[model samples]
Target: MRLFAVLLLALLPSLGQAAFRCGTGLVDEGDWPVEVEERCGEPDYVAVYPEASLPGIGIVQTVEHWYYNPGPSSFIRRLVFRNGRLQSEDSLGYGFLPGAAGDCNPRVLNEGMSEFEVVRRCGEPLSKRVTWVASDAYSRYSERRSGLQGVYPVEEWMYEFGSNQFRRIVTFRDGRITDVESAGKPQ
Candidate 1:
């Protein structure tokens, strides 16, 4: 378990300077296997960490973290795998704990995080749930994608979870947010 958490952190460029989170994100599902040599590369994740989004079914995820040998002052990379697949494949970026080492695959989000920043860390939203007349809601927008690697537009945000210091980020596609909920305390 310790080794797996380390590899997840090492993947985040920002967190690269410190340790990383565990494999809190999804990995692979359906047709993709845990083939590090095939899935990792380009964009954000490598052939090793392929995520699958299937609601309550496919939630497979993997993360590469880091570890430091206090004695030798050396760093090592580790990988962790989780079952099931999420719905979104692309990630915006990630949220990390300040001084908590690398981007340790933040199992839980930190206190402050923004929609843009979340996108930078994780990828885009594959799908979302939306509702009008609600301050805390998600909107979605999409492009006319019609190819294998379709340039599908994706975005999301969390409304209820935003206030003072903490907020919920909703994802957006063209100009709307998807299904979102709150999960933090107000500043």
Candidate 2:
């Protein structure tokens, strides 16, 4: 019995490995976007960004994040695709029902959460501004080594709760939240 228990523990992590199921089909990393779409159907939301450009090769690598919300009972799943192939999968917080407004509470916002998470919790922002900033020294060095220039996208999403509440500004860098600030109450 003890030996069996140990073996089961060893297999636990493997059982939780990243994979998404759709009806009878399962999608895994390295699969094509078409394969994932065929199995999982269209995603609830999709965000695409250019990751890097290699001038020498005349190649631009784009990254796409496809979000699936399988209702409130299941965790939301994000499928990441790089250069048209599935690269990784992530499980996020519980999903809400379709067509329902997100349960937005500014206090819950924090750094390091993905832009997808913010959208999932707050629905759409009233206004969004996008900018491109030069990559950090480390990222620039790495990209330069590969004959690529590093410029990353930065976005600011502003949300207004109500007349009685303060407006919030959320800043995202490289697809992740970097800062959140509370603006004065709406005029």
Candidate 3:
């Protein structure tokens, strides 16, 4: 009984990460976006970008990032999609509960995190970009009142943690994290 109990405890983290799986193998890179959603259900967070016209392909591609918070013991999984297909996958390190204790770890910062929460966890960013959106250009959802429109605040905060490590850029709209994208390897 004790041996069985020990084995169960050891299996917990893998089990949590495997909570969502596809037939035969776990959902992985190259899996279609639809297959991922169907097997894993909805992700914890989603960041959609404006459509971009591919230079010569004449194809308009939609890119997106989906984040999943498995559990405390498991790392958050980030899935990148391009043109409705999974393009890449990354383990962004350990996950944590919302409003948890102070942590400078970037993995704790996630989409929908408020500006205050970000500062509280990771302190001020290396740089910041603020823009006043006069129209609904970046709005993901339509405004309820068509006539009531005015400039809204949008910001992008970049955190540089030095060379070869993952860097993060957090986007905020109305002071809340609308998207969190991983930048290229720190240089």
Candidate 4:
């Protein structure tokens, strides 16, 4: 019985794929946006990516990430939707109280952090710029046969700490931070 229970516990993650509770309700992959909204209520933040076009599929899917911060006692949840269906879910570090400013320490910022994580820790930026870059998909049979996978959005967010501090610019690609740089104070 003990071995059986342990095996079951080990397999549970594979069995469930991924899911999270919303009050008394549960949201899982493949759930519709409306159902998630109904179960989880409004999200704290939402990021929408431009439509991705496959080689033969035309413009078949649009991607969005909805972030929910259920206060300081719980972990933040990020629900990813593609074409109106929940494709996956992620749990961020921790939730923060609504309307409270996040820690804006520039030293704490680093690469590979998700957009939600940045927002959770640093709050909103002073200004933002967005652009789309083309990503390539290679053929399985031949590496030479490359095609346009899709255009992914890249965003640069600027944060100003104080007059004595240099402004920091954080760049994100595919929802993850790729670079952080400093610029002179605004004139």
Candidate 3, 66-117: lDDT as tens digits: 8776767987766777667776666665776755676676677777665555
> Model 4 over residues 1-187: C-alpha lDDT tens digits?
9999999999988766777678789888999999999998988889986545555556545678998888889888888887789988877776878878767688978998778878777888999987655533312221232233554456899988788889999998657788999988976
**Candidate ordering by TM-score (highest first):** 4, 2, 3, 1
Candidate with maximal lDDT: 2
Q: Which stretches of candidate 1 lie over 4 Å from their true place?
A: 1-33, 37-145, 148-155, 159-169, 174-187
Candidate 4 TM-score to native: 0.76
Q: What is the lDDT of residue 170 in candidate 4?
A: 97
Maximum-TM-score candidate:
4
Query: What's the residue-level lDDT of 95 in candidate 2?
Result: 82
Candidate 1 has an lDDT of 0.32
All candidates' TM-scores?
0.21, 0.74, 0.42, 0.76
Deviation (Å) of 95 in candidate 2: 1.7
Deviation in Å, model 1, residue 24 alpha carbon: 23
Task: Compute the lDDT of residue 178 as modeled in candidate 1.
Answer: 41
CA error at residue 49 for candidate 3, angstroms: 0.6
**lDDT, each prediction:** 0.32, 0.78, 0.65, 0.77
lDDT of 2 by residue, 120-164 (tens): 778888898866556576457636644557554567899998999
Q: Clash number for model 1?
A: 76
Which model, 2 or 4, shows the larger lDDT?
A: 2
